[model samples]
Target: MKLNLFFQLSAWCICLCFSPVLAQQNYRNNEDINKALRNLVNNHKSHASLKSLTKTLGGKDVWVLTLSNGKPEAHPAIVIAGGVSGNHLLGIELSVKMAERILTNYKSVLNQTTFYIFPNLSPDATAQYFGKLKYERVANAKKTDDDRDGSINEDGFEDLNNDKLITLIRVEDPTGDYMPLEEDPRIMVKANPQKGEKGTHKIFSEGIDNDKDGVFNEDGIGGVAFNKNLTYNYPYFKSGAGEHAVSELENRALLDFLYERWNIHSILTFGPSNNLSVPLKYNSDRANKRIITSILKKDEKLNKHISEIYNKITKTKDAPKSVTAGGGFFEWSYFHFGRHAMSTPAWWFPKFEGDSLVKAPKNRKANFLKWAEQEGIENTFVEWTSIKHPDFPNKKVEVGGIVPFIMDNPPYSKVDSIAIKHSEFIIEIAKIQPDLKLINLKTEDLGSNLTRITVDLYNKGLLPTHTEMGAKSKWLRKINVSLKLGKGQEVLSGKKRLVLGIIEEDSSKQLSWLIKGRGKLQIEATTPHAGKQSITINL
Candidate 1:
């Protein structure tokens, strides 16, 4: 009996050691996510607070978690957003997990930097992953007519093979625009007319043309995509981009919350777009244009520096290039919102390195399949099965393709480590936020009870107090330096209060003032985003 009890106690200790890993064995649904968020606030009430910015059309709460030791607006802030794309479930997981890890281990950093985490921004569409008929959905549940055919969701996807999964359907035809790649026949690629490639197969989303408009699944369920519903470079009249920019309730809610928070200096998003692994290049013409499309030269330099830090901390390499689509949240955050914005898909299929004799495939689909096979990931691809279709009755048609959401999100077992690396990266970034300091103080005793006071207002952190674009934007607050005089004191020379421009990292500006009379004078430098500093001197 004594031996059995000892063994039981040992087993309990082992379980405790691996509890965190075991708990995250699967992705959380909306209910689970809400409960987990509530529990986090309950457990870490001192440093973490949870609030719902608004409810989506699907009746899901768009939650934002604010993490700080003191008043959140009093310190420099970074906004970490996730689920910018509904198909990327890993993003939602990363945002929530990063918050939990930060509050648990890196709680000390909260004293200097505040974090506003918007996890699962596309909750309405992300919920479709857990729904029965799963596909790579991007839009919310606002009921849109995507194709503008005067019909609402009439040509949505159908489970042609009764598989309960929305895969692809291919039909053999002479005039087809798509053809199977020679390297991997399982994958399809657009036929290149310039390369003398002949088309043999036509592909469409697994569905029939219910509207009889010759388009299959053109208008699906759901409405605006949050990533494509922002104000910058909006894709007008585009599917999933909404009727206009900031049209959705979730979009308006997020922007309203962001506009109210003057302390947010930078924005980081976990989604399909990536600018962290490889920084964006600066184009002189684009930067000089009236609208300013490209990243400013100084800001581009900062992006490159931060990219190096991200690659070093995450050790991520050979990331696939992702283009910033019009109206993307990633671009809007920087171009229009005027903050230091950075985004990453957070995960991707690592580059396939074959032996000397075996050359890797060039096509993305072929490469992903090769990696998936090596990793022993199963059920990722559905085998092609012949099915009789109503649309193409004469031609031979089949349904099969890579499963939805798997390519963008890794298996659940790998998420914890991914979350840890991202959490570390975020903490490192917070440590380097622009910190204002008053240094190099000097005082001279002038004749006739007059005194000369000199000090250098310095930005000691690694990042500039304002991003180059932010400096030009009227939305951001300027750095204000003020001299508060004691009783019977008057300024004789320099202005009592002065507004300053951008302060580059590790740079300082000297300010000298002549006072007619002084007892105890206080000098204070304040900025909503860079933080505040003050000092007192006696004469």
Candidate 2:
């Protein structure tokens, strides 16, 4: 009996040591995510709180986890958002795992920096990954008529091959615009007419035209995409963009929460749009226009600096440049919300290196498949199989391609390591947030009981107190330097309250006041985005 009890206790100890690793072995569903978040908050009650902002159209809760050691509003804040694109499941995983790692190991980071983490903004669409028929979905559950053909969801994808996965179908035809690449026959590329290449095949999604409208799988179930529904450069009249910007519940809820949090100095998003691996360039023409569309010159310089730091910390190389389509939250956070916004896909297939005798393929798909083969990753490609299609009965139709979500997300085993590196990057960014300090104080006594008080308000942090674009925005509060006087204090020079327009990083502005005063007095410097500091002086 004693030996059995000892064995049972030993087994329990082993389970406790490896339980977290076991739980993270697979991508989590909505229920699992909710439970994980609740457990974190319950375990770390003093530093974490989870709130359900609202439910997505699919009834999944849109949760925001606030982590701070003290009052969240009192400290400079950073917003870490994930799942901006529904198809990027790795983003959701990274966001949640970063939060978990922070709560478990990096609790000291919360002392000066508050974090507002939006784990999964596209819950409705991300759920499709775990559904019966898996494909790359980007829309929510709003019941949108994507093709606008008067009928809703009539032309959805059909599993013709009975493979339980939605891939691509190609047809061999003389007038086709796409052709298989010569280097790798498994991958397809659009025929380049400029290079004298002739089309040999046409490719379409693995689906039948159920609506018989010539387009295959154009309109499907679900509604607006959260990433495409934001208010920056909104794609009007486009499918999945909704009737107007900020139309979906998830987008509106997130924006509303962000608008109210004036302490948020920067936003870090895990999404397909990337400005971290490679920074944005400044265009003089666009920056000078009445409506600015480019990053300001100063902001562009800051972006480059941060990009260098990100590369050094993450050791990520050869990151592919991604364009921000209209209505993406990544650009919206910078252009419209007026904050330091940064985004990255967080994971991609490593660049394929060929031997000196062979050149690497330029096509992304071809290169990805080559790298997958070298890494011994299996099941990423579905072999092309002949299938009888209703639309192309006369031609040879085959269904096959790279599997959905594999190219965008790494395998589950690699998630923890990726999350750790990204979490370190986030902590480095938080450490450099704008911090205000009062330094270089001088007091001179004049002849007749009068004194002159002077001090330099300095920004000691690496980032400026206000971004160049944020300085023009009315939403961001201005730096206020005020003097609190004793009973008999009189200000003979300098305004009692001074508004410093903007303070660059590692820079200072001198403020001097001629006063006829006595007894104890106080001076305070405050801003919502950068923290506040106060000093007491005895006259």
Candidate 3:
């Protein structure tokens, strides 16, 4: 009874937690959604755009909802886009949740900030979950002839085993290139090419190749993978990533709105790349091992803990194995415009951090199986079962794997926790306000017609005025204090303000300059995020 009550309570919280989503209609029949989005644009006092915000993509309008502090001209902006691939419901939910959070907490986060929030990038794809999805496919409802032999989504598969799961099946053939599951012994692996060892295996999707394209049903369904369609590493001539980067009207519409409206300083996108969380590969580029040391520098206990579980914790791939590259979000922010950017995985297979158990490599699959059963992710991947195949024989099909909604897609219960944690991180970084003000200025008049003016610059927030790299590269603006007296202001000696390296939270740096014969003079201070301030002096 207690366990049942816990689940009931969890179910209730799911409903309450996603009440915001209740406001969002299914994209297919989302007339109400359009109206709600339009209403938000009209009602919000801060600058917002409902005009030219939507564009026809694959025969439907994709909407771009923007929020900002009222400004006369285009302000630098950040675009947080989700539901790009259509299958990623968590992405859409998070982006919307974040926008809502920002609006409610406007006094703190939304100040001097303009945000472009597209909660659902692939509305067509998202509508699949409306009542029941046939095969759990359909992110964009795109009927593209994926195999290009001329039919569309025609060659699809199904869960013939009654396991309620769709997975690859391997049948043993004398000429095939896949081997029996070596690691898990129940799963299969691609045969090694170097050994010239023959593999007697043939792999097929859960269903027949309805189109008979000689390659099974490779081109299943849905709109293009939007992230893979961006211009930088745009899979130009590659199959479904699109004709070019930002080629889809859906992608173009949002890109146009962001680039035109906001001069974004930084971007923290949830994707498959990294900048803020550096892959080990970048450490060699810096040469200053301090950056690497700083991250690995903490908690010897954690280090010792990892040593017990993982033999090779070295990061092998910071990117996908695919050759068709879409110069992703990290590149767009970091390389193209020189903005600080970070892209993190929304979820990953567990790393052995002592927080999770240390399963032997041989027992890894079994451990995952055990945990999945306990955690309820087993709802997706069914147990390995035998099945008869037309092409090959004597094969047991393991329908269970990591391709499930539970782990790859974190539960709604975790959204609030991650939101609060990420929000705090954003605030911590946001505090790097370079804006210095003329807090105090005093002049002591000398009898010989000379006066000394002192100035103080205070850091208004958390992060220091400049990063060590920013200071060294002069990428960050220099804070200068000047006391001027008309033309040819008699100056004793102009001393350059000293940057005490990095300034911590709520710290102040002071400067004093001397000048003679002052009729009218001005003193000013500057920073990147805080705008600027100045004051006038006369004697």
State the displacement of the C-alpha of residue 42, model 3, in Å, after optimal TM-score superposition.
8.6
- Tens digit of lDDT per residue, candidate 2, span 1-539? 99999999999999999998897776888788889899989999999999999998789999999999889999999999988999988888888899999888888988889999999999999999999999999999888788888888878888989989999999999899998898888988889999999889999999999888889999988779888898878999999999999988999899899999999999999888888899999999999988899999999999999999999989998898776889999888888888998999998899889888766888888999889888899999999999999999898999999999999999899998999999999899888889999998888999586999999999988999989888876657889999999998999999999888679988999989988878887899999789998898887
Give the alpha carbon lDDT tens digit for every residue of 359-458 in model 1: 6898888888888888898888898899999889898999999998988899998898899999998898888889899999999998898999999999
| Stretches of candidate 1 exceeding 4 Å from the true structure | 1-23, 356-358
Each candidate's TM vs. the true structure? 0.96, 0.96, 0.65
Q: Which of candidates 1 and 3 is the stronger one according to TM-score? A: 1
Residue 386 in candidate 3, Cα distance off native in Å: 5.9
Question: What is the lDDT, from 0 to 100, of the residue 420 in candidate 2?
Answer: 95
Please estimate how well model 2 matches the true structure, expressed as its whole-model Cα lDDT.
0.90
TM-score of 3: 0.65
Instruction: Please give, for residues 1-539, the per-residue lDDT of candidate 3 as tens digits.
Output: 99999999999999999986774432223354556567666666565665545544545567666676665223334556666544555666566556656666543545655566676666665555452423444234445666666666776665556655565666656677877654355555667779765676666666666655556656676646566666554555555566557766666776676555424444556544433233323233343543222212111222232222222222322222222145354444443333344454444444322225544343444445445555665354555566765433355433334343433445556666555545544444444433355677788998587888887777664334443333443444455554445865677756533334444446777777778775888766654333455788885
lDDT of each: 0.91, 0.90, 0.53
lDDT of 2 at 295: 94
Evaluated at residue 525, the lDDT of candidate 1 is: 98
